[model samples]
Target: MGVPLLAIVAWSGTGKTTLLQQVIPLLKARGIRTGLIKHTHHQMDIDTPGKDSYLLRKAGADQVIVASHQRWALMCETPDKPLDLADLAARMDYSALDLVLVEGFKDEPVAKIALWRRGVKGEVADLLDEHVIALVSDENLTIDLPLLDINQPVKIADFIENWLR
Candidate 1:
């Protein structure tokens, strides 16, 4: 693998983003340069409507890249077909990252960790899938694979660190 990838899959209100927000900084403290890819089902627009970049894109520009001192963004109009996870991950700067944390895209055939909280969605039955390598949950239940605590980001970070090794 060019860059190690892990998918954080969960139910709608399962605190997937919350746990990751806490976990990412801990990984950074451990000298891990992480990259992220988030999948959203909604109609996406990262640019403002009246901005020059947005205006240009509206004017039928197939692809537009806006650059500045701090950062740059690539805006491409691809409504013909949906994007692929592997293809999107391949587009990243592989040499600069130790891991890529993907949020959502549970249906994709990738190594994943299912996140769950006890009271959030009643139970963990719906979150389990074929690709799950581990289960992160609040309540302990019998399972064959590794089970990590949902409340402990440090433990989760440790688990991820071990996985990276």
Candidate 2:
């Protein structure tokens, strides 16, 4: 199992999901199997009300897992509870994945690439205070870590691979 994981963190509206949408495919093209975990500040539900899975949860099940021939999903009924990222990682099939690209969890200890956009900001936030090993931005930054062009996914992927390896 060669599962290398990292977080792509940014403030709200920084295009974190868009960046992942671009990077994941490039990583896959390079033969990296990617997995992702996105942290949200609000309550979220993958299953809707009155659905079978939702009913199972409403009936007091702590967790409900649904599977098909092609894919599987689990909805855990813990709207107010926080999840442990490490435990979640451990539970995943890392044996088949090459990289786990987590989106958010800005305060987590995981190594991350801070995403920033210039020309449209107030004081830049301190992502470096977290475990940010690199910066991904559209303009020049004064951070101590290596900085990569936000549009260059291949270079970023190489940096990540080298850092993990």
Candidate 3:
């Protein structure tokens, strides 16, 4: 692979976003480029109402893409068909990026760092099986993997560094 990819997974409210918010800047400080793919359970609109892109889509454009100096947005019309996460990942700028840290897609067959909190009542990381190669937790996990403290961003970065190497 041209660029390394990692999936950070956790149950709702397990602090996955909080963890990423810290880790991403830390990785960037180390001269590593990072791309993020976040999955949401609700409908999303990259283009807002009254915008030209949104208006085009309202007028029955299957896909409307608006590009600017800093960023670009694409709104595709798919009322019934959902695009797979892997396909979305492929569309990213992975060739020029160093790492793609994906959030969610717990059921997808991708390498993952599973996050868990003790007494919080959630499914085991083991439920993900072999795809989950490491654990970040606040409780003692019986699984045979490298366990790191939930707040230890450096250690977590070190694990990614070592694992990618």
Q: Model 3: per-residue lDDT, tens digit, 1-165?
A: 456668998888888899999888888888778888898888788888897888888999998889999998666787888758767777787766888899988888888999988666677744456888899988776778888889899889888877877
Please identify which of the two predictions, 1 or 2, would achieve the higher TM-score against the true structure.
1
Please give each candidate's TM-score. Answer: 0.93, 0.88, 0.90
lDDT of 1: 0.89
TM-score, ranked from best to worst? 1, 3, 2
> Residue-wise lDDT of candidate 2 within 76-138, one digit each (tens)?
766586788886777678787877888998888888888888654434566666578888888
**Model 2: residue 89 alpha-carbon error in angstroms:** 1.2
Estimate candidate 2's RMSD in Å: 2.2
Instruction: Say which prediction, candidate 1 or candidate 3, comes out ahead on TM-score.
Output: 1
Clashing pairs in 2: none
Look at candidate 3 and tell me the lDDT of residue 29: 85
**lDDT of model number 3:** 0.82
Candidate 1 residue lDDT tens string, 74-99: 87788996879998898889999999
Runs in model 3 deviating more than 4 A are 125-127
Model 1: worst 10 consecutive residues (lDDT sum):
118-127
